[model samples]
Target: MSSSKKARTHPQYELLYWPGKMPGRGEFIRLVFEAAGVSYRDVSNEEENGMKIILDMISPESTGDSDSNPPVFAPPALRIPGEGKDGKALLIYQTPSILSYLGDRLGLAGEDEAEKAWVLSHALTALDLNNEAHDTHHPIAVAEFYEDQKEESLKKAKNFREVRIPKFLGFFERVLKGNEKQGEGKYLVGSKLSFADTTVWHVLNGLQFAFPKELGSRKKEFPTLFETFYQSVQEQSRLKEYLASDRRFPFSQGIYRYYPELDRQ
Candidate 1:
C-alpha cells in the first residue's frame, strides 16, 4: 500500500499573503506548519516580502518557462519550489486548498481516508465561520476602514454575537459532540489533532480579541467551543509561546480589529 506520509523535500515555501500576520486565511495554513514544527519562509506580498510577492504573482516575468497561475484577487497563496533554484509551482487563492495541501505534505493530516475526510470537512467548516466573522466589520463597505463602518459594524456585530455566533458555535459543538460520541477528545477528530483544532483556535483568538464585550458576555454560552479553545491555547506549546512572543505579531490591522465602540456591549 502507498504510504500516507510524505517525505519532506524543501522547507522553503513562499506564502503569498498580506505583509503582516493578522491570522487571516493564510494563518490556517501557518498554524498547521507551526504545530508540525516545519520550517518555512512565509513570504508575504504586502508586508515584508511585498516586492517578491508582487513579482511572483502578477509579474509575468517570474513565470519563466513554466505555466502561470497567480492569485485570482489577493494573497494567501503558495509557491512550492521545484527541481532547480527558481523552479516553483504557483498555487494561488483559497484557504482550504492551501491548508489541505500543506496538511498532506507535512504528514500532519489524518490517518486513514475517512479520518482525512472528517478533518478536512471540519477544517472547511472553520473557514466558513472565519469569513463570517470578517464580514461583520466590512459587511457594508469592504473598501472602507473599520472607523468608516462603525455604525454598520455595531449593528452587524450584534447580529453576529446573537445569531451568527450561536449558529456556528452549535455546528462546531456538534462536531465535537460527534467526536465525543466516537470516544475522542483533545482534538476535533476521533483522536488526534488536525486542521479543525487550529482553525478553531485562530477564530477564537480573533473573536476574543476583536469583540471582547460581546465575546465575553456570550462566550460562556458556547461551552464546548469555549472549553476546546481554552484547552487548545493551553496545550499548544509552540502556539502559546508564539502568542507570547513577537513572531506571532499582534492583532490590529487584519480581519479582526479592536474598535472600542464595536467591542463593547
Candidate 2:
C-alpha cells in the first residue's frame, strides 16, 4: 500500500441567514457552535449568491417541490451535511429548535435528560426576551420601517424599558439566585455551562446594545445574575476568541436596534 494518508472529513454545517451587518437570530446558533469548537460555514453575506440560496430554499417553488422534506418558513436555517433521509443533507430552521439540536449534538444541552429540560426551558424564556426586544422598534409591523411606526414605538419602548425589561431580568435573577442557593453553582442549570447560559448572555448583550442607558442603570439589581453571567461568558477562552474575531458579526439593525428616540431612560 502507498504511504500517503487519507484526509479526515468533518461534517459541514451551513447557516442560511439574511445578508447584512447585523448578527440577528443567527447569533444564538453561532454561539453554540463557537463554544463547542465546531466549525461551520456562515454563508449569509460571506459567500457569493448567499442571499439567493436562502431565497430559493424558502421560496414557494423549492419548498413546494420538496414533498418529502419539510418547508422552511424563514432564514436562519441550518443545513447539515449527509444527515438527512438516504444520506442527504438535513435542513433545520427556527432558532429555538436549531439551538436545541446543536446544543444536544455538541454536549452543551446538559449532563442528563432532566438537566437538558431545564436548559431548554431557560433558553426558550431567553428567546421570549429577544422577541420583545425586537418588537420595541417595530411594535406595529416587522415589514415596516421604524420611522413608519415611530409614534407607536415610543410608547411601546417606554413600557419595555420600564416594565418588561425588569420583569424578565428579575425572573432570571431569581432563577440564578435559586440555583446558587441550592448549590447548583453559578450556571443557569446544574454546575456546568449549558446552552441556556449562552442564550442568556446573548440576550443580555442585545438588551445592553439596544438600551444601554436603561440596562446600565439597573446593573446594580442583577449584579450576580445577568451581569456576572455575561462577564463569565465573555471570559470563555474559545468564545472570547470568536467574539473578537472577524467572523463574529456585531449588533446592528437586526433584532435589537438602537433608535435614539426610543431609547429614552
Q: Largest lDDT belongs to which candidate? A: 2
TM per candidate comes to 0.83, 0.92
Per-residue alpha-carbon lDDT of candidate 2 for residues 76-145, written as tens digits (9 for 90 to 100) = 8988878877777888899989988888888889889998999999999999999999898899999999
C-alpha lDDT score of every prediction, in listed order? 0.70, 0.82
Which stretches of candidate 1 lie above 4 Å from their native place? 1-9, 45-52, 55-67, 83-90, 181-184
Clashing pairs in 1: 19-47, 45-50, 82-87
Model 1 Cα shift for residue 145 (angstroms): 2.7
Error of 2 at 102 (Å): 0.7
Instruction: Give the alpha carbon lDDT tens digit for every residue of 14-102 in model 1.
Output: 67776655566777777777777666666662356575664556554454425355434556776676623445565656788878888
TM-score of candidate 1 versus the correct structure, residues matched by position: 0.83
